[model samples]
Target: MQIQKINLGAEPSGIGGDSARTSNGKVNTNFDAVVAEFADVRASIPSVTSDLGQSTTIAISQKLFTDTLMSQFNDIGVQGALGFGTGITNKLPTGMSQMQGTAIKGHENWGNYQYSDGSVMVYVPRFYYRWGHVNSPNYAKYGVNALDVKSIYDFVDVVAANAAGYALHRAFYDDGQIKDGFFVDKYQCSNNAGKASSIKNGIPLSSSSANAPFSGLTGAPANTLAGAIDAAKTRGSAFFATTIFIQRALSLLSMAHAQAATSSAACAWYDATGVNNFPKGNNNNALRDVNDTAVLYEGTGYLTAGKTGSAQPFAKTTHNGQYSGVADLNGNMWEVALGLTQTAGSFYVLRTSAKASALTSGATLATDAWGTAAMTASYDSLGASYGELTGVVRNFAIGSTTNQVFSTANSGLAWSASCAGIPQLGGAGGTNAYGNDRFYDNRIEHLCPIVGGNWSYGAYAGVWAVHCYFSRTNGDHHFGVRAALYSV
Candidate 1:
């Protein structure tokens, strides 16, 4: 690893002057070079010697040496050419606007949510972006089409330290710039300001040595689940026994976190399925206590952009399930999150606890990030005609015939107060996958009101299975149902 190589293709340093009075001025330039990012266990631990109470200083210094050594050769590039130099800034990496200045790209680090109802929710990060370089301008602008088409996957294991977390990872980190940039690569920090910025580059983000690298969001992203185990085993003296205990510990924690996790707060994951030849389903606990890697794994701790709510809605709702920040709820079931709030009418109830106190809110109503509808609304109101007597769903029809029809347009179909019996399409619904299509769910909570009722939903073949939720009415009465924003 070169120590201060700049894009000039050679090491950039001062040439010793001929005159006895050499220059004594300091300049601020990126010391672009290879770096070893790791931590000193001994420095942090009290005793790690044979005496178990020996010199803390020696132990720390030793661990520090190892950390530095491993990071030097730690980066094992599996996919493309890997090198360090001032050229990093020559092509600044892009991430979520909030993750600015981070060397590592996000999304390549986490997974999304999957539910008991065969539903899944995800927030696609701005993983695909073009960098129109703006380094105070006399600078150059770069895009993916220009430099080495590298990837963060090449270093996932090194970053997370746990290949297990790589399992079930689903994400698409692409650099859309076709003409001027480089493919996604890990962000390598350049020097910092004022002090020795050189060491800044070596400060990788993850806190684990391996295995449990991810953000500490609740539920799936909890740092302690896989991470705590990694720490206990890798950092402890009894590697074997400690690992077993950690596994048991993680199970308890997962269930707890899972228990508390609401749909809106589910942790997201990266799509590790084949894009990088990663295994299909990551083993839940493969390296429970194994930290054989010679160096510390330094990468982002969390992979998600906005999964702060790890606790269950039971814990968040101010009204005790009456009202909350759920996404798949009725319009009245409102709260706020950057993503979206959904009224539960459109969402299909799919668990033993479909009602309040049973199921928590679904994944946060996420607008599409991959398709053209990312900015569309995340929820729709299941109101009036599709009324609720008590929390149960009821249907109301207005057409002369029993057959109910729906259009892509927000046609007010069943929303009549005085039994005109028309159904309506919500304007706030997320756009469907197929242009404005409708999805028919045989799993209607129940049919109500008018004599024998009929509900019909139609959309282009592409529209029915769309992302939006639909509510149906059989008769005039409203149905009673627990609602919240939902994601499938």
Candidate 2:
């Protein structure tokens, strides 16, 4: 047990060659130069753990001097834990790659947009149908399980008048397999289902022969409105099936604006009594299923013949409530858009051609003779103009001033605050009391555009309702077509 050599430096240990201080000189605590600098930091700990696990090149220059001292002490390092680093042996400084090209392309919902006149626009949001159709298999049993929808189902072959243009041309031209293989027209509404060889009564005329004589000269991607805007431009690029602007049909009626308070006053009709906006025997516009089924459809009204009343299914009609993402819109039936018109004293518009060169200088762009010299590209009713309104108002009257109407007058076509001057809106089962009012009048030529509102007008089937009094060659059962796309 021989341990004794506490010298504490500055010298005096074996006593007297230097200073170790004491004898009132008082100076200690250098425990042998802190035990020889803790034995030289425990012999440089395995060479600083093998230079931080072989990051060598002297651990990348001591990790770039410990990331510049952790970015000037605590700004955190490794560029916030590995984010930037590419090419030129990366140590990243600016390279979001391009030209110095190290491969750095990033964008998530990338649809592409640039136009400020620099022109580039591409947008393909899942091929935008805005949330209209797409569920199919004839929607299980003709869809609408919004939960249960009171059981009973047949839906009178799914509410005719072109079954919302045959379920929006079978969710994108006969069961959209990417718009049925890059589109070659597959709209089918009556070529087989209710067969007559093609009895033109559900008239949207695509003609597989049989009585085909509505003569907008026969062509049927889904039958007119220029074959549902050429099958909604095959799901992209300015496609249209009648949303002829009015602020793009009130941005699709503020996406079913809160079912205008309980589906706009309800009405599958049955003497909807007192009618203070037609609430009487309400069904909140049919089709339920929040927990199980049956939200209101006590029957007696698909015009009675076998009663298909409560309606609401297909895509499960979701105004601004519940099913939210755009569906039946307001009641089901009646959607007809394609350019918009009102004629006389000014309101005409035939658009496209980049919306008539972007309007405003007495607004031009019409031509192609602007209809009537046998207008081509589908639709002719013997041509007076079917590119969108020419004339021939005959029985439902209101024609003869030369045509092209629907106004709210901001002076020569502007209307939209739910459409001013005329083209009235707001789903009205009966009296959702102007559920959001407006439905203009003062007819002009074959009017056209008759959006949302049918199932017997329970509170006026809304989504900005408008029935410009028939005539784009009129096809009833209630009339339908919805599927739009846009680019540029």
Candidate 3:
């Protein structure tokens, strides 16, 4: 393929320059004109090089000379765009925010947690933003709209690169702007849920008050784990592997954070007012009050403000945002995540241990990125699976432990035989206020963990909760996914 011409249209420097200029401080109209004329020459070299190969000395010299010249031209363009020369320091780009000063937007400074190694793990804090769509029309009510969008599909890859992390591939780059916002659909998704009807834009707040406007809060948002990821991919051009999903370890860490932030300390479920409200079920809302009945009183009335009076269906409890600095994390839908499972007496999980530092971002999800190591092949050892995977999961959930330390593995395995993969976190239904129920053996066919109690389980939803009762292949109205950005 030919090297694409750098379009310095109007502004000779795409980065920021108003007009082209020379080192001598003269208007560099000549340079721009020359570059434009020879742009086709640079573009055509790809075909020429392919025909000639690299055998002859003359051909090699020509290729190098042309490449160097083009590089110099691009460098000049970048320098002009940036309004600075090479080796200059402390110069801020034009249009940068004076308050933050730093060009980086998504780095979580105020609300963040520290890792064992003393490195800080930043949260995007702001609500999720998808690429390519203009701000949601419901920006006034949702308060999630932004002029720019930032997404990090791979957190491990970002931390590994550290300061130079910007080079890592992300769904949204530094210059990217917020486009379409993915909303939780009020309807459930099936394999056929990929159809047009099921995939409706998120219902805006003012769209319908008679029914709960929040999507996928009670019922599972249709689709398998794989399907959920695919839907996220549709809004962007970036290639994301399984790296975007929440991991078992991260899920537990979030639980601990929530638990610590509460007055009860032991209880992970707390509403906006610090009171524990159960996940809303059919009886809670007029729209959802259908065949299902647990005889429990649950309802969060939408008092013209998009929230309920007693128990809000999908209305984020005030407590959800306190701990993680993220809203609606605890109780809503059971989030499908990357975790462990057992089916036909075989264990399936991500092959490598889920440590933030040991991972790398892949170019594509299906091809070379996520085969054996990213997602492991099913193993024969049911004994190892039960002992290592299942037991650890149980301890983390019921043992009242906080902050399970993550270790660096040498084998590059995301998970070990002794480790039970914590799959999903937070749901809509459960018996406890914190929604800690992992004994649903029927749903745990593959033993995948679903967290944050759903609508069906009132008073049982909390931060350190799990519902590992569903099969990975199964899709319910309670299953949904949350999106995060790595800030690269």
Candidate 4:
């Protein structure tokens, strides 16, 4: 029986096309209409660093997005994107190219190829391609998975307003090899991962080392802050100075916890195995597998010297031998502190109280001051914010036990209908208690405190440590200590 004619138009049957007669009475030669499949692969390591000054954060707030800082951040992308495009120089094994990418330019998972030791260096994987056929519906949906996140041009819109831009450190690309190359690639990030790839040039990370130490130095260009690394290498000092983007750090800290709850995947610390000279051990490319490994997000904050109790700890306690340094939440992150006067009813250990920029003005103590001084990324019951609403306090009720009635969203705390929209109201309570009737899934935080003595580290404290390590040996998971910092 003769084969059915294929519709090369709307529905392509995976196969190229069906035979067709030429209107010219000759054999048809329009076979060039179909797009040729290809693949794109690159390395995922090799980063450039950045810096800002060390001084009163208030002094240099205006310079946050200065050109110098922008230049530095942009360089991070240059190193990560281009560096991974090939591979680091003088590092690959004998058969491997000096700059390593994928073995097959077009085969699926081509760049997804892993080294024998399990050390992953490729920019992205083929799974992005595996998810969809060239013309399938899934392809159109997840097509952004194939974008190069390390590109200086990839992330711009989020930098301006979109909070998701902060979560978009991850990105992917396709260059026709495994998927599609030649700018025909697809991509995605927190929300704007591939947003500015067309026009905006990114700020690089190269300036961080020097600018990190200056006052008012922020954004991607703090010079003085970067210089503090060597001096503050012990415990979390490095974390305090390493200048991690708030969005990046918070997103990273939450990633493991989120994944653990949703997918049961224990967070794997990036060993930095065989990785060297890369800033934050990432080189800026969003392309990464981490294989079974995860990364410690870098973060920075300033602490006042007087804080010794709950007044200073962001997590409400200090960890990693650091009260004023960087943070690695995966392991040693703890509630930290600063400017802690041993006042009446004060046990000061919470870093959020001191180190945090007061959410409001007037420079009041971060402790006990709700919506006035304490600084934190806020969210309440109903996944909303207190500032969005205003009202008086009310009482709480814990419904009858039914498996503890614990909804991750609701936690064990039940609210009286009089309670504000914030499901977990916080004021003066212990552990889970926040206010007259609100509470936290695990208290250490939450505005509802039913009594005196702000108890830091009420529950869920110190689950893991975070850091930046250098990979010396290729296969071994042993991380070479480069510079590390951790908190709670």
TM-score of each: 0.18, 0.23, 0.38, 0.22
Instruction: Choose the strongest candidate by TM-score.
Output: 3
* lDDT pick, better of 1 and 3: 3
Give per-residue CA lDDT, model 2, range 128-162, as digits (tens): 11121234222332122100110001123323412
User: lDDT of all predictions, in order shown?
Assistant: 0.18, 0.28, 0.29, 0.19
lDDT of 1 by residue, 140-171 (tens): 31111111111233333322422211111111
Q: Tell me the number of clashing residue pairs for each predicted model.
A: 91, 32, 51, 153
Q: After superposition, how far is residue 325 of candidate 1 from its true place, in Å?
A: 20
Cα RMSD, model 4: 22.6
* Candidate 2 Cα errors over 4 Å, as ranges: 1-112, 116-166, 169-370, 374-377, 380-437, 446-488
Give the better candidate number (3 or 4) by TM-score: 3
| Cα lDDT tens digits for candidate 3, 91-165 | 222211112211221121222322221212223211211211234232232122111112232223444433321
Give candidate 2's TM-score. 0.23
Candidate 2 positional error at 37, Å: 52
Which regions of candidate 4 deviate over 4 angstroms?
1-72, 75-152, 159-327, 336-488
Best by lDDT: 3
Off by over 4 Å in 3: 1-225, 237-255, 258-320, 353-384, 387-397, 400-435, 439-449, 485-487
Worst 10 residues of 3 by lDDT: 79-88
